[model samples]
Target: MAGVESAVPGASAGPELAVDGASNPDIDLLYDINGLTKSTPDWLDRAIGFVGEYGLLIALVVLVLWCWASVRRRPEPEVSVAGLVWAPLAAGIAVLINIPIRGFVERPRPFVDHSGLELLVDGKSDFSFVSDHATLAMALGVGLFVANRKFGLIGIALALVEGFCRVFMGVHYPTDVVGGFALGTATTLLLAPLAMALLTPVVTAVSRSRAGFLVRARRVPLPHPAVDLPEPRVADDATDTGSGRNDLAA
Candidate 1:
C-alpha cells in the first residue's frame, strides 16, 4: 500500500515511510491511538504523559506503604506484611526478567520504526518488546492483591491505566503492554508461594522482638478475671458457752 501522511503536526514521516509494506494491525492501532493526541491541548498531553510515566507509579508505591501499615495492625501482621513486601521484590525481579526478553526480541520503539508518532517523553533508547512500566505496575498490583484484596484491586486498575497510557504515548505496542502484564502476573503468582515462605519467618521474628512495632501496633493486655473466696464461719456458739460458765461461777 502507498504511504499515508502523519497526523502529528511536526511529524516528518509516516509509518509507511519507515517500513515500506502493507500495514499490519499493530502499527495501524498505534497510529489510531496516538492520533488522539494531535487535537488535545499541549498541557493535557503533558499531563497524561506525566501521569503515565511517573505519577501512577508513585501512587502505587504509596498504596503499598498504606497496605503495609494496615496489615501490621492485624493479629498476625508478619504473614500479611510478608506478602506485601514481596510486591516490590516481584516488580524488580520482573523488570530484570524483561531485560533478556527485550534484548531477545529487539523490537524498536514505535516512534523509531514508524515515523509520525508524537513522542511524549524522550530518552527511551532501549528495546520496546515489553514495557517496563506495565510490567512494574502489574507486578506491584498483583503482589498487593496477594497481600490484601481491596488494595490489590486498586493496584490492578492503576496498572490497566498505565498500559493504556504507554500505547497512547506512542512509546510501545499493545502487545508489549500485554506481554508485560503476562510477565508481571506470572512472576508474582508463580513465585509467590516461595517468596512468602522465605519472607514470613523473618517478618515474624521482627514482630516478636523489640522491633515488633514495625509489624504491628502495641497490643493492650487483657484484664485478668477477679477471684471470689468464702468467708470464715464465726465462733459465736463457743463464746456464748464460755460466757455462761463464767456467770455460774460468779
Candidate 2:
C-alpha cells in the first residue's frame, strides 16, 4: 500500500499541492468571455483614430473663431470685448483644473491593464483615471454654453462626439471618459461663475479702453429719431361739419 501511494504521481507533493494545482473552472470561463475577440472594422478604426487625434483641437479652434466672429458682429462693443476675454479665460481655467485632477486619479489605461483588449492607438499614459480628451471637451462645451446658450449646446454635442470617439478608438475605458466629463462639468459649474465675476471688471475696462477703436472702425452708427412732433391737427372744417351734424340731429 505504502509503495503504491508513493508511486502515485502527486502523492508526495501533498494535498496543498493538489489544491494549488487545481484549475478553476469559473476563472477559465471568465477568461474565455473576456478574451472573446472581435475585429474592429477598418473604416471605424480609422475614423475613430482621426477624431481622437485631431477633432478636439479643430473643434476648439473653430469655436474660438466662431465666438470671435459672433462678438465682432454684435452692435454693442462692450459685449463683443466681454465675449473674447471671457471665453479664453474660462477655457484656460477649465484646462488647469482638469489636468491636476486627472494626474491625481492616475487610473490605469484600459489597454495597458485590461487583458485581451486591443489598442488601436498606442497611448503612453500611466494615468488614465479620467480622460483628458473628455475633460477638455466638457470644459469647452460648458464654457461656450456659459458664454452663449445656443453655441454652448453645439459645443456640448461636439464634446460628446469627441469623448465617444476616445472609447471607440479603444484608447480609454467608458468609465474614464465618464469620470473626466463629470470632473469637467463640475469644474465648469463651480469655476465659471467665479471666473466671470473676476473677469467682469477686466472685461469692462478693456471694452471701455477699446471703445475709441470701435468708434473709428465703425461702418455705421445706430439710427436715431430725426424729430419729435406734436399730435397732428385735423382739418377745422371737417371737425366743424361733424359737430354741426351731431347738433342738428340732436
**Top of the candidates by TM-score:** 1
**Cα lDDT listed for each candidate:** 0.85, 0.60
Worst 10 residues of 2 by lDDT: 1-10
Q: Tell me the TM-score of each prediction against the true structure.
A: 0.79, 0.64
Off by over 4 Å in 1: 1-23, 220-250
Error of 1 at 49 (Å): 1.0
- lDDT, residue 154, candidate 2: 85
Candidate 2 segments exceeding 4 Å error: 1-40, 77-84, 210-217, 220-250
Residue 219 lDDT in model 2? 57
* Candidate 2 per-residue C-alpha lDDT over 1-250 given as tens digits, one digit per residue, 9 for 90 to 100: 0001111232222111012211854223323322322444556666667777686758775985686556555566454445445555655666677677656655555444334443546644556657777877777777777766777788888888877677655556666677768877877778766676776566667545756443123458779878879888777998999999999999
Q: Residues 123-232, candidate 1: write the lDDT tens digits.
A: 88777878999999999999999999999999999999999899988888887889899999999999999999999999989988999898898878999887777788
